[model samples]
Target: MDNSNSNSNSNNSHEGCYFNRLLEYTSDSVEFYPSFKNSTLFTAGTYQIEQGDTEYKERRKGRLYLFDIEKDNKVKELQSIDFNSGILDMKWTHHNNISQQYENDAPLLGVVMSRGELNVYRLNAADQEQGERRLELVCRNDVSLDPSILTLSLDWRTDNKEIVTSYSDGSLALFDVDGGAVTNRWIAHDYEAWICAYNYHNTSMVFSGGDDCKFKVWDTRTIEAEDGGRSNSSGATPIFTKRCDMGVTSIHCHPALENIVAVGSYDECVRIWDLRSMKQPLTQTDSLGGGVWRIKWSPSDNNHLVTACMGGGFHTLSSEDGTFTDLSIKSSYQGPHQSIAYGVDWSYTNSSSTDKQQYIGCCSFYDRCLSVWTP
Candidate 1:
């Protein structure tokens, strides 16, 4: 597909390094552990909260902090740095995003930014803020894999030592954590490749969605280095490509289904595709009003799917037949309705032995707010 018809947003440019929406806060910002047993929400952007026995919060200026939420909802201030690099996405590790070699020591989580920089930091156990636990840079690609990338997704291979990241630049690259280099790179789409995921049930499978309005299923096993690895430097060749309509920003696999995948797009639609029929989506659901940015499959249930959109709203969809119902918490605070929901994660935090409901962690862009929703 030719990108000639694409309209460019200046704020999306990496060279300018200007974020259009900035959240300004007044007064000394108070940090709350949203995961705490007593708190209902956790807010952290300008300040760092270390929740534990001491319960202390350290404030920072001009730095974005990465906080690790424990099972108890306690937030551990993980990493803090001065750079205002727009972190597009981050993935937590079962072992770590970095390597098993460091598992015995400090495991690392991978953070991808809009500036095309990737960083891996050793997660340190903290009771409080000690001098500086600076994040270690395993690899930094000064230039983006896709120059015009609007979104990113990082998923570790079944082995956990390898990570594959998809970009809006219409490309997908697989990196070996130990080698600290990209093992495979494929031009997956014509427009922005928004989101990507690995089929955890099947190790060799992967998927990506983007502005081209297509969701593609790929078999890494058939994909080999394009130059036959004869020159030993040319990247891998994509073995398969499929197309679906409307610029997709999010793509995820059905937690229990083998060949089923779902994608969300700019056309305000969510589509599900089967590998057997790739030309058109098998199922499609319209977004009530907003452009959906992220779609996630519930880790706890195979039939439940969740999505967050740009208009400060979210929805829960039934995977049984692609039917969706609106789901957002009632805000008593009556705060800003412009909170663009950028990130969402499902947690089994408060589940009891007999109860099966899962909690969700959502991050808002405009307000820099993180909210926990129980459903």
Candidate 2:
């Protein structure tokens, strides 16, 4: 396949808008699980191969790579770590006083394993002068749930001490980092809770979506009754609930815009909602042509968002108008032809002041590829 391709819809209002690929990386047989923190990129994946006619075996071992963008606008691999399990998700916490103690130390990284374990790692900046520094495992915690349940998604609080996770068993849990224990756990949905997120402006509240085809909001304070007994009856009731045509696949609260959120569903539409009034969506886009697996709001631009469509490839949606409109940037890989776009994130660093150009990093599942571009 050609490494780069460009095409645009003639009917698209913004026909001149095009996405230029800045970096492309492909793995031989392993898939890439990619995440970004500022200018640095991290990826991990497992290797698998067929053993015989009907049996297959996984190497179990996984590899993690770190890439940093240089002054000349080139990305270079800075470090690699070997792990015993495949990585499902990775997040970097906000820079806080605790993380600022060490000079040149990278932000704390939270790693979610495919087998239901959460590990925190930090870059060892103390020995950079001596030799190549590596990541040090600072803390590890196992989310105690049904053995069959896998942690599907997680979000860190801005304070950097707590993390909220969603599980395959349709449950949500809050974990305390210092205490190394689950602070709270509740059943949030009837089926797999695919996504859970913290409202950045209001940390006490959380939002989650699941295969049950519902988007719900929860308040942590209501976990226990006034008498101190667990409130099993009313505790599970969400502050608000909205049903979609298909399973809700992803949910993201706007980073800067409070009360505004972007919700994606298996129905191939991304709906923008205002928390104040949920009777109807503020605006809904036309069919995006695939299950929207991930939605990321650009840190640089408030009106822009990027979607990882499982079947339609990648798309950039802008809300500068009253409603969200598709920019129709060029995408080389559409689903069913190669693989589904599973992971997508926007880089926080933006050098341009006039033009709203920021780096976007995306990874495809079965294609085992990662690409960075600007739309």
Candidate 3:
């Protein structure tokens, strides 16, 4: 939603998107659905402009901003979609009873890009109408198998079919969101795998993180179909792997606690691993000064969790019932989020609001900030 100039009033339909735009670049990701009354936001961003000669490409295309979280929290922008490349992460997928999905389907938006596409948009929003909203385009799904890779992160597999992608080189793809298929492709990580997840309490269990400091676990069933799953140079060898303390980016798998994971690194700590009895970190968090790209868990509150921390900013982790024993760290209104704190989300309201109430939606990067922190 940037470079301003798209909405004439309403009525775009969805072809190349570009409707109701206005979000001017660099604010990497933020997602929250929480709407029965108040919450539905998506914010994505990217930029680069060079053109001609070497081309310098970084902004092939990107713009997805749809906000409306007003309940006194206030966000209200409401419409923009413009996709094609350079977005790098976005997930919403609905039908909450707790997301085993399928109440009839309806809401879905799972994107990842830079050029290695894997899209799926279609926000029925209870059958449109408000400003004649539109995002439509159910599947693009390329997943970049051969070489030209770029898709950074994704994770949807609660029953929304499947999606678990993360790649820059150091691959790991498995998408099949309604058969726009890429079934499985692998490499697992020796370099930039950023993050990959799907273990909303065991969706066959898969999780990864890396710039090559490793923290892995994969067993889609032990993935081995040979070439139909495609490109598997010995793909399934991580029923376990761990060596953190630096480059492990972020990973979150703890919807209602079953293996309970929450890792983040670049050495700025925040581990909470318990994957079948941990190897270390049952709790850790000392330096939240930077480097923890994102880790969010609390769609309905298991104990509460959220963190962005890129230049060290958004933080909140509480522990009690799910029992990590005693863990508490809170820095929610950090001076007003200066920069780098990539993205964060956790706002599914039923509104009993207490236990120090926290409702968040954040985004930042090179000062393209977007925030809404309700208490």
Candidate 4:
């Protein structure tokens, strides 16, 4: 059987591409769902960018606008939330099993404000009559060691009832919505914690990275309760910790594999580690120039990973060895004019169908745009 011919035919039916411009021209964020050919792109400040709304009114000045991308590259206004502070990061939770309880409800959208307040917003179309969406304060905790919350990450737990956040002050906290409290908190590192990712394959595992020149792993199951604590000789309580050498910029747990992690660092390399052995990385490679700012493992395949470098271009690395293939985004009306690549996501298409082909989605720093690439 001609596998190439078979693969090509399958991809053609599933693969689609489009772009949504952020309402604000700043370094904003974008997420896409290609099967729906719909996307959400928002910027810090906001105005309104509707068709023929105003000739040249700035839509990204007051509110963070969320627009939905339709079939014809047309963006529809979905919802808008005004913030006294700018928006940091936003993630939509996938309703794997939680949708059963809500019945006819939209997935929850988690947002981290510039002031370091993490808020969870449940999209409820059931109450269109209220004309007002409810903004539930899931859990609010101030993580200000220097009066600045550099970055925050929010990932849903396996139970989908709780979320994990990594603060700038080198702290990791897990918030339970049902309990209305932070169930666990640990000072996993000594510097700014830039990223935190929960391994869905291994629900009890949490991975974090930061400016402390280390990427540490913490087992959520080993979290110390309010009273069950014992201190070491130095009076430091033992926490489930494993450290890397350089300041870690980004981290992702292998989607399908258990306990395997990909950590990108300021050392311009990506390190793959195993939680079972904490001595050293299982594999390491210097594919990213300047520094590997962001790295992501393919959700569809555990052996494939992607990296975004600081000043250099992006690279697709093999999980077998640390070898990588460089990818260049075309500057044609879309991108590569952007300075650095910051965020990357994978879009799996034709879920109900048998096709398994998926494309990588990326957004960069300077020129605010989104690009999709496939092997």
Candidate 5:
């Protein structure tokens, strides 16, 4: 896959660093728990199952693996847990205030199971009888009454009190983290709702993209499922919507900005948008050479955006004043993984404000490869 045809408005002269393999394992998704800043600890969900199959059969192929990011750039596996089908996405709840003791003194994890459910887990300590050191199921919320309706992705609401999940059946669900129940749901797309997120700056706002090629915005406060947790009624209509050239696959709300969101699609382009005005994209980048599967904004730097572009590889872009102009590869075809880049995440520990270098965790499907990109 030659990348000569693409255009990145800025020179990608990687003078001081190069891509290096920090781990070798087949994984479908990877995420770092911010609470482990002193010693970075992350989780990797394996496989990339499609649709939904017999849960009892596909469950054997899905496993969530834990790894610790070491001081010397090497990683070690800490533990592993079994599950029903592949994990399409994993998100650890973030803490805005460090003093509050959360569930089991650890951040809660919500995983999008390809078997049509969103499962939450808590990390328990393996030694002192604390649960934060091991992955333990907290609760399971099945978005669809039908077990085969796979959930594709999920996002933690800005307050970390609720969750919004996208499903393969073209619907969305709002799950309350503390309540461990689906508060609301509705049909939001004509095709698969590939991705969804709550705008960080607005508590009542949400955005979704689907295989139907529509980018829609909703006012969560006003959306009421016409029929208990399932509906296509006018009561659930989105506030704003626009069509994309292709299926929208990924979306990430900026951590520190208002009305700013980055969206990626099957068209292989990344677009920056200001939620206030959706008539046109604020900025658009050249083709990334593959389907953009997942996206993450640097926790410490909102200007930096990372994405897993299936065949093209993983990328890090510079977004200045909402413009994603300086695009560069953190890992690509010339590097590791040789398969569909299904998941990627930025390390909060190394990318702190005082640190100049950044570490990224990425996983590829099919071949099941997991690697860290060290600068």
Candidate 6:
């Protein structure tokens, strides 16, 4: 596929919002996890199973692929591993820990499986030079939850040692990598907790959105009981809850700004909220056609964001005027298509010298494809 296209505004406005497809990849199943860190992009491919397919008894596996962003702005496949189960969510640690007197230490990758298993793997440099094309991830720790409950989403703590996961059964869990145990777990919502994330600025605070149409804030410090065991009740009460027009789908905290959060809902709108006051959203974007499934803040810019709309293709949003405009993808084709954009993420590395262009990766559900572009 040609990776170049002219940059043009969606409606000829002055915001200069435009994106061009740079690369594309096809997978066997839907690609759910598209994470970018350092100079590598980590993606997991998962296939959907029929509800009553009794003939397919064997456990299905998935592929974990790694792509490196080259200096010439092209992506090269680095390695791939066939995991035991389909990955629903994956996150790369933010801290590398190499500067903390650890020799040759690379960041950890946390993988959440469809069967409710959580595993942490260390990227070993020793395996990279073994002459084999594929690099093996050294398993550092593995924690399995109740096999009946499926994990939906997960976020890594800034320390790169712990992770918090949301589940299908309206529960939240925190796992410690070094100790290989679940440090805390609680009933967080009344319905499926679709998304959960750590407030990188404050490790004690977590943000979660659920199918209950509520966005909630959780404090881990209060989850402990007075007697030093897990609390029997729901543990701690939510610090705040904001009801939305539809079920909440995604939430992303601002990378640089403290207390600022971007929330996406099935109502087809993205709302920016301030944690100090939950009375109202600071700004809400106009509809982007289909429901907003994913929202990602740019790692390089605090004011920019991108979203994967279920029916709206993909969009680039700006917060310059305290409101969201339709800076969606500009295309010659018109009208609705059947593809559902399920995953979206921004590359941590900038592709342009002036920071005018950055790499973005997105995957579609029905289409079973991954696209790398810039907006």
Best by TM-score: 5
**Where is the poorest 10-residue window by lDDT in model 1?**
25-34
Model 5: per-residue Cα lDDT over 1-375, one tens digit each: 232311211222233222323222346788887653423567888753434674543543477877765544456566776664667778887643322324245677889877777888887666665333567788887766466777888887757789899888788888877777777888889889999987867778888999999888989888765555654443488998888799999998877676778889999988888777878878788888888888888765657778899988877877555444444444343255678888888766433334444577777776666666663
Is 3 or 4 the stronger prediction by TM-score?
A: 4
Q: Write the per-residue lDDT of candidate 4 for residues 55-165, one digit (tens) a residue.
A: 322222224444433343343444555654445455555432211222233456666655556666654332467543333444454433322554356666666677777
> In candidate 6, what are the lDDT values of residues 1-375, reduced to their tens digit?
222321221131212222212122323222212222243444445445434555322354555665544443445555555654556777666532212211234656677766677766655443545522333454533343455567778888887667888888888878776667677778888898889998878888899999999999988887763322232247568889999999898998876677888899999988888887788888777788878888877665566788888878778777664333223333211112237776777665433434344566666665555555545
lDDT of 4: 0.53
TM-score of each: 0.65, 0.76, 0.31, 0.68, 0.83, 0.77
- State the lDDT of candidate 3 residue by residue for 207-270, as single tens digits: 8898888988898877765565667555478888889768888898776667778888888777
Task: RMSD for all candidates, in order, please.
Answer: 12.5, 7.4, 18.8, 10.0, 7.3, 6.9
lDDT of 1 at 146: 37
Runs of candidate 4 exceeding 4 Å displacement: 1-17, 20-25, 32-69, 72-77, 94-106, 124-147, 225-245, 320-334, 350-359, 370-375
Candidate 2, residues 1-375, lDDT tens digits: the string is: 232221211121222222222212322111111222334434433332323564221323345555543333344455666555456566666532222322344567777654567888776553657543456789987774543466777777777788888878788888888888777778888898888888776878889999999999888777643222211133577899999998898888876677888999999889888888888888877788889888877665667878888778778787655243333333333322256666777665444333334556666665565455555
Better of 1 and 2 by TM-score: 2
Which residue pairs does candidate 3 place in steric collision?
1-23, 1-63, 1-64
The lDDT for every candidate, in the order shown, is 0.52, 0.63, 0.69, 0.53, 0.71, 0.63
Selected candidate, larger lDDT, 2 vs 3: 3
Clashes of 2: 0
| Candidate 3 lDDT for residue 141 | 62
Model 2 Cα shift for residue 3 (angstroms): 20
Give the best candidate by lDDT: 5
lDDT score at residue 118, model 2, on the 0-100 scale: 85
